[model samples]
Structure formats: structure tokens, C-alpha cells
Target: MRRLRQLAERTPAGRERYVDLLRALAIVMVVLGHWGITVIGYDRAGRPTGHSALGDLPWAWPLTWVAQVMPVFFLVGGYANAASLTARRSRGGDATGWLIDRSARLVRPTTALLVVLVVGAAVAHLRGADPTEIRTVVWFATIPLWFLVAYLVVVPLTPPMYALHRRFGLVVPLVLVGLVALGDLGRILGPAGLATGNYLFGWLAVHQLGFAWYDARSPTNPPRRRLPTSRRTGAVLLAVGLVVLVLLTVVGPYPVAMLNVPGARLDNAAPPSLALLAVATAQLGLILLLQAPARRWLRRSGPWQAVIAVNSVVLTVFLWHLTAAVLLIGLLDALGVLPTPRVGSAAWWAWRVPWLLALAVVLAALVAVFGPIEARTRRHGDTTARGRRRTALAVAGYAGVVAGLLLNSLTRKAAPEPLGLPTPALLAYLAGAGVLRLLRSGWGSRG
Candidate 1:
């Protein structure tokens, strides 16, 4: 805490401290929302299972608009990624090197989670745990991977997509919106899975908007950028976003909930509908509207320190919080202490208070366990190799990691389920890493 305070005090001048605050806020909301909604139950034979409260509480649909914070992360990612790319290029860093730097932080931590999940599943299988129970647990644990996989699909595109952002400005996101509209149309029409394409287009739109936010205060923009101008822009965005949202949900084919409710035919969140993009626009506007004052508030050492503390372990918290929740569910169930009040009952709401507290403690312990691995994933000063070989290795390596995540997630499937420890995905990922290591080693030639 003391060190973070000192670090906060030494924060570089002209830094956009509010971005960190927004990210931290988003992480908090995600953790709290997930923990609160997650409810675990046991089958008649004592097998554990899990589900969301959103399924039972139809009245709570509108509340999800504020809770669905994924767009905020992408928004911040855009600003931060843009800043990083600009800075790296300024320092003579190419896209290949930049990709390597970015991938290390994300992939290393993700690898740790996958390794642990595979090992845990293996141990359960060796002990003769029921296949149904194991699959349920694995599915619950890998929920975070859904977002992670989607983000991975987009992360590699930062360089090229960012180039489009620079070349076309706001037109990039506008085009993405058109793409999302097309996707939404396909989703609503015959083949619903066609909307899955929006996972990239939708998030890319929010991310591209982040670039717009960054551009407002960019070095290229006027230094004397007036507050009223940005605020006016924000207001227009807010108005347009709300109008579109109403049209999509009320007048069009989307659902009211911003989240992907279980078993819903039209999931606004899973593939991300235009309605969700509407929500993102509103959230982005709210972010822009609040940025100036938020930065001013973040000037306080106390608030800034908290933001730093959370951001430091943000990935760890996100990765393991659900795991912690799952463990607690089993433990509390065994001890006959896990609450099972009716879904929307007053007693159920009462149980959430203690349930969340317990989950937080477990999550804190998990973060403490895994946070150091994340801390150690820092950028080395080693220069990357340049050439076609370098680009090929980096791209292949990144694709391997993504394939590995997707394959590991497949273990969560029913019917022809994987027995344990997703070996193929693990090998694929290892092979990818080997190629990346070869890339780093200059492809058997000196850099």
C-alpha cells in the first residue's frame, strides 16, 4: 500500500489517470456483478452445478445496462493500445515487436489459468469423479475464457485495425457499425450463428470509439482543447446512443437485458447485438463526459492509490475470482451452509451479502497466489527480430494461443466430453510458444 501510494504520487505529469480509474471501476463492477449473480446448487445426488440469477429475475433486465462493463474495457484498451503503439513506433518498435510485448502479458497469465484448470481436472478424473460433475465445474471455471477468447481474436488485429483508425478516423467505427448491423440481421434471420461474427465487429466498434476518445486529447489535437467541445460531443453521443438503444430493443428485435440471458434465442451480449453497441456508445459517452472531472478527482493520492492497487492485480482477480467462487460453493455446500433460498426471494437477497463476502475473501487469496506471476510478466528490453520470418512466427504463435484457448474451452462440452487436462490444446499452445521462442532466438540466425 505504501509503495503504491508513493508510485501514485510519482505518476508522470500529463498522464491520463482517469483511464486507470475507468479500468479499475470496470473490473470492480465485473467482479461484483459476477459474484452476485452466480448461484451454485447441487443435484439430487449431490452433484454440484451453477447458474445465474438473471434467469430467475426478469425484472432486473434493465439493471444490466450499467452492469455490462465489457465495452468499457475495450474502450480503455483502445486508448491504451493506441498510446502504446504510438510510443513504441516513436521508439523504433515495429508491429511484430509490439505484438510480442502485448502477447506476453496476456498469454502468460492466461497460460497459468489453463494449466491449473487442466491439472485440476486431471486429478478429479484420477480420483474417479463423476464426468458430469467435472464438466460442470470446468464449464463454470472457464466462463472468463469466453471474454478472453473474444478479446484474443481482436488483440492481434490492433496493429492493422489501428492503422485503419488512423487512416479513416471515425469512419472505421462507422463501417464496423454497418458490419454489426448486417450481423444482427443475419442473427435475427435464418442462421443465428452468423451473428457470432459481431463478436469481433461489435467489440471492434467500441474499441475504435476508444481511439476517438484518445484522439480528443491526442498530441495531434489542439492542446487548448476546450472542455465544452468534448462535452458537446459526449452529449451528442449520449443522445444518439439512447435513441438507438430504444429503437433496437423496443422497436426492433433485440432483448431488453444487456446480458446474454440463459437459453434466450436472441442474446444481445453473447455475440453482441447492435443494441449492445448502442449501450457501448452510451457508456463511451458517459466516459467522455466524466473524463475531465474524473481526472481532477483522481488527482487525490488516496483515490489514485486504490486505482493502482486494483489495476495491479486486475487480470489475476478476473481470472481466479470465479474459481474462488466455485470452490466456496463446494465448500459451503458440503458444510450445509450454502444458502438455497428461492431465486428472487427476500431471503435470497439476504444471503447474497454473506455469500459475496465469502467469495471476496477466497478471491483475494487466489489473487495473492497468482498475482506474482502476473507481476513478473514485464517487458524485457531485448529487441525483436525483423523480417518475414519474424512476422510469421509472431502471427502463428498468437494464433496458437487463441486456438489453445478455444480448444481448452471445448472440454466444457457435453456428449463426447474430454476426460481431463485438454492435452491437444495444451500441445498446440506449447508448439506455438516454441515457435515464438524460436522467433525470439532469431530463427537460428543472429539478429
Candidate 2:
């Protein structure tokens, strides 16, 4: 614990290389996981429709364990919140305003991206594609959008959550572990009632653990003085996390790898498991231990500046990358050049390599067109006339979204249901409106 405090104390301010490196790692893993999914086919219900274990690769499950799922993303997010909130406090920013600002950044990009996808889905349906098939594709494509909703919910709670960190620290993770264990025991050993509710709470409990870590590490003063003891504490926490993970897998009913089996009714990932919680703790602990090394390396690298420059665009990429993938696949198919979509075949999986490459090309193209527009839009908080107009526009936009979601729920399908997407679209629209309102106010106040 003392060593841990010393390491953290040595970390320079506004120079969070460890966190940034962890962020890049999380993003790259997420993208790779998504790219892998494109190769694996899905049925009209959005279940995995193919398997790749036939390649006889023994490393398959282990690879999935390392690459798939969203735990790492949430872990890094907690770190960012801690750093950002601490920085904001030093600058005298109000908690409500900070929440509002962060929420706007998250919501608007998602809204812009989802509107494009929904419009595209409508067009595909009109063109006589199987409604169920297209609906399933859209359902599958919207998986990444959940991060926006989850982050918004988690970020605003940071103020209180940070308080929990100060009080409980390591005990926080223990309590979460207990909750997850009880949830798992109920589902796997007993009547299995309310598994869905348990699932939501269970996964969110893991996200809160990240918040706790941030609180422990973040302080208004120099970090070392506040942190109990950095190096020894970090190592012990990491070791404990690993032991818990091994025990859960050995004694529990769940598989360690997160991705669902083809045709499996329930997925470990959709409502993540204790295994994931274990993985997150271990990952977070290790990252904390390596903070000093990461900071030193990042300080020396000029390329990191470029990554930090675009750090704000991570949400934009996650929201729209799937759309870019869909566009690339459709374009190639229309030209009669790309192979047709298939299920349960090695050759089909093989074609995904090139499709992923094309997905990259398409994402770059979208960024080229919309990136500047998004950048300029965020700066709108500087003037009053434009602020008032933008606020009005945002209100109207949110009203439209409410109407659309209600209609979809009544007439089309239940969102957040079996292979559905209600949370992302709804949350995105709300967040976008909030962003517009803020920017308008910022602009008006400046004037």
C-alpha cells in the first residue's frame, strides 16, 4: 500500500499516460471484437449463427476471453471519470454543470449516428428486404450503442460514487462480489427467477467498482499523501482479483469466455457474469500497478499527443463504426463484386478479413465528412442568439425522438427485449438534446 501511494505521487498532473494507454487498449480490443463478430453470422433473431472451433485452434476460447466483452471499457471509463472530476474540481466547476457537459459530449454523437442508421433501416425495409432479417441486423449492429446509455447513467453518479470510494475503498469491491455471487447462486442453483433484473444490477455493480477505484486514487491534493499505500496495495488487490476469478470459474456454472454460443438462448455477455467482474478487478488492479511505467513511457512518446487529441472522438467511432461496416458490405454486394453473406462456413468467415478492412475505409470516409461538423457544433456554447435557437431546435428534436420510441414500442417491437435496442436510441436522442441545450447556453452566456 505504501509503495502504491509513492508510485501514484510520482505521477505528473494532466499527464495521465497510464489511463490513456489503457483507454487505447480497451478501444482496440472492442473494435477487434466487433470485427470478429462480422465474420460470425447471425440468424434473423440476432443469435450467433456460426461457429469457428472447427479451425481446430486450441487458442480460440482463450482469445475470446481476452478480447470480447465490455468490462475493460467500463474500467477505463471509471479512471477517466476520476481524473476528469478531480481536474474539474480544481478548476471550480460545479458538479451539475460537469455532469451536464460530459453527458452532452456522450449523447450528441450517438444521436447523429443512430438517426442515420434508423433512416437507412427504413430505406432497406421499403426496398423489400425481409423485415425480420433487416430488423435483426439493425438489432445486432446497435450493440455498441449501449455504452453511451450506461456511461451517462454512471458518470452523473460519480460525485456520490466518489464518496463511497473514500469511505470503503477495497470493501466496495467485496460488497459487489457478494452481490454478484448471490445473483449467480440464485440463477444457477435455485429457481432462477428475475434473472434479467439480477443481470442488470449485477453488471452495473461491476461498473461501480471502477468508480470506487477512481475515488481512492483521485484527490484535490498530491496523490501520494492521500493514497494509503500504492504499490503493495495495488498488487494485493490484483492478486485477490485473480484468485476470485479462478475460484468463480472452477466452482460456478458459467463459462469464463463472454461471447454466447451459437443458438444459445442466454448469453453470459448480454447480462454479464461474475466471471466478468473478476476479470475487471484483475485488469483494474494491474493497470493501477503499472501507472508509473505507463506515465513515463507516454511522456516520452510524441505519437501519444495525436491520440490524446482525438480522445474525445472515441464515442463517435464506437457509435458509427458498425454503420460504416454495414455500408461497406452493402456497397460491395451491390457492385456484384463482394461475396454474398453466408452462415456456418470457413470461406464465409475468411471474407470478413477484407470486409473489416473496407469497414475501416468507410469509417474514415464518414469521419472526413462529419468529424468537422461535430467539432464545430460542440463549440456552440460560446454565443447567446445561437444558443437560444439551438436550445429550441434540441427540444423539438427530443420531442420527435420520444414520439418515435413510443410508436416503435407500440407498433413495431419491444426494445431492450430479446435481441432488441431501446436504450441506445432513446438515450442518444435525450443526450443529443441536452448537448444542444448546453452549447446554446454556453454561447449565450459568452455573448
Candidate 3:
């Protein structure tokens, strides 16, 4: 802890603490939101059953607009990636090298989660656990990996996208938003296939805006030509986004909930809608409006150090949070100590405080054990034959991870047996990790 404080104090003068602060807050909100909405219970036969609380509490829909922080996550990702890429370029690094470095940070922590899930599933199957139950558990546990899959795709595209941002400024995101609108329209009137495009377009749009923000505040830019960096600009963003959000939900086909509500006729989030983009716009505005004060507050050692520590294990916390919730709840259930309340009842709401605390404790323990995998820095080999091969191996490694997660998501319930894990996905993930390990070892050659 003391070391983290010292590290924070040494932060570069040009570094924006507020960006890290936003990322930490966004991750916390997501974890808490997932914990709150997930309602797990045991059936009469003591089998576990679960669903999101949002299914029963329709009125809580509006709360999702605030709780859904994916946009902010992507926005911050853009800012951080832009800064990172720029710094790497200044040092004469190529896009491939920059990508390898960034991807390592995400994939390392993710590999730990995937490996654990595979082992746990195999162990449960060996113990004569119901395949159906095992499948459900594994699927639910891996839900958080969806973000990793999306983010991995976006990270590799950052170099080219940042270049586009430089040439066209805010037009990139604007065009992306326009595409999101078209995707939504297609979902309404055309083949359902077009809706899937939003999965990329929506997030890419928000990410592009982050580049805009970075360029707007670039220290080298002349003051006169810089984009308006005032509170007024943020206010305009807030107003326009809010107005569009209301219109989309109230007057258009979109739902007010920013998240995908079970059995909802139109999900604003499954394939992000223009409405979701509007929410993101409003969120970016709100974040900008508070940036000045947030930056000032973050200058203090205590607050900034906390942010640094959280950011250090951000991926670990996200990847393991659901597992922590499941472990805690499953243990309590097995012991007959788990509380089951009606989804929206006062009792259920009251239990949330303790539920969150218990989950946090479990998550913390998981982090303590697994977080170091993410923090451990790998040695970069010289840019020789070995280094190029290492880069190729790294790309294959990330590809395997991305493919495995994507396949897992797509085929989650495709199997007839409950206990069946996606064999192909598991193999791909393991193979990728193995290749990365070999590369890290310099392909069996001495360092």
C-alpha cells in the first residue's frame, strides 16, 4: 500500500488522474450493479435458480440509465489508449508493438479466469455434478468475459482509429453514431442481422469520442484552434444527449432501461441503440463537467493512491467479481444460510447492503491471489528474429482468447447436456495461453 502511494506521487506531470479515477469508478459501479440486479435462489429441490431483479421491478428501469457505465468505460479506454499510443510513437514504437503491450495487460488477467473456470468445471464433472447445473454455472461465471472480447477487438483498432480522429476530429464518432442509428432502424424494419453491427459500432463510437477529448486537450495544440474545452461545451453535450434520450425512449421504439431487461420487447443494450449512445453522450458530458473538481481532488496523495491501486487490478476485479458472487452465494446456499427474498421486496432490498459487503470480501481475496498475474511485467525481447516471432505468437495468443470467449458466448446453451463445456472454446483458450507462455520463455531459448 505504501509502495502504491509512492508510485502515485511519481505520476508524470502531464498524466490525467481524472481518467483513471473515472475508470475505477466505472468498474466499481458495474460490479455493484451486477451484484444488486442478480437474484439467486434455491428451488424446493435445493437447485439454484437465478435471474436479474430488473425483470420484476419495471420502475427501476430509469436507474439503469445511470448504472450502465459501459460507455464511460470505452470512453476512458479511448483516452488512455490514445495517450499510450502517442507515447509509444514518440519512442518510435510501431502499432504492432503498442498492441502487443496493451493486449498483454488484458489477456494475462483474463487467462487466469479462463483457466480457473476450466479446472473448476472439470473437477465438478468428475465429482458427478449435474451437467446442466455445471453448464449454467460456467456460463454465468463467464458473463463478464464479453467485455474483454469487445475490448480486445477495439484495442487493436486504436492506432488506425486514432489516426482517423486526428484527420477528421469529432466527425469519426458522429459518423459512428449515425451508423448506430442505422443499425437500430434495421433492427426495426430490416433483417434482424443488421442489429448485430451495433455491437461494434456503438462502442467504437464512444471510444472515438475519447480520442476527440484527448486531442481537444492536447498541450501542443494552439489555444485558438483547440476544441472548446469549457464547461459550456459539456453542458451542451448534456442537454442534447438528454433530449435525444428522452425522445428515443418516449417517442421512439427504444426502452428507457440502458441495460437489457429480461423479456423486454426492445432491448436498448443487447445491441446498443441510439438511445444508449445518447446516454453515453450525456455521461461523457457529466464526466467533463466534473473533471476540474475531480482533478483537483485527485491531486491529493490519499485519493490518487487509491485510484492507482484499483487501476492496477482493474481487470482482475472485473473478471472475478461474478465468480466471487457465485462462490459466496453457493457456499451460503449449501450451508442453508442463504436468504431468498422476493425480487423487489423490501427484505430483498435490505439484504443488498450485506450481500454487497460479503461479495466484496470474497472478491478481495480472489484479487489478492490472482491480481499479481496482471501486475507482473513481462520482459520485452530485442527486436530481432526472436522478437518478431514473439509478436506473431502474441497475436495468435490474443486471437485464440478472443475466439474462445466469442464461441463460448455464442454456444453457451447450445449443448443438450448441462454439464458440457464448449470443448473447442476451451481448447482454443488453452492453446493460446500455452503459445503465449512459450513465447514468453523465448521459444525455449535462453533469455
Off-target runs (Cα >4 Å) in candidate 3 are: 43-45, 219-227, 378-395, 414-420, 435-447
* Candidate 2 ranges beyond 4 A from true positions: 1-13, 40-59, 125-134, 190-212, 215-238, 264-266, 340-352, 373-447
Greater TM-score among 1 and 2 belongs to 1
Task: Report the Cα lDDT for residue 141, model 1.
Answer: 79
Residue 38 Cα positional deviation in candidate 2, in Å, after optimal superposition: 3.0
Q: After superposition, how far is residue 373 of candidate 1 from its true place, in Å?
A: 1.0
> How far in Å is the alpha carbon of 411 misplaced in model 1?
4.7
Please write out the lDDT profile of model 2 over residues 12-101, one tens digit for every residue. Answer: 675656656666667766775676655444458633333334233334644565665467677667767767777766766544445545
Model 2 CA lDDT for position 46? 39
lDDT of 3 by residue, 113-218 (tens): 8778778877888898777777778888888877878888788789889888877777777888888888888888987788888988889998987777777776
The predictions' CA RMSDs to the true structure, in order, are: 2.6, 7.6, 2.7
Clashes of each: 0, 17, 4
**For candidate 1, lDDT tens digit of each residue in 37-132?**
876666787666667889888899889888999999998888888878778888887877777777766776777787787778778878887766
Alpha-carbon deviation at 7 in model 2, angstroms: 26
Backbone clashes in model 3? 4
Report how far residue 353 has shifted in candidate 3, in Å. Answer: 1.0
What C-alpha lDDT, on a 0 to 100 scale, does residue 425 get in candidate 2?
44
Any idea how many clashes model 2 has?
Answer: 17
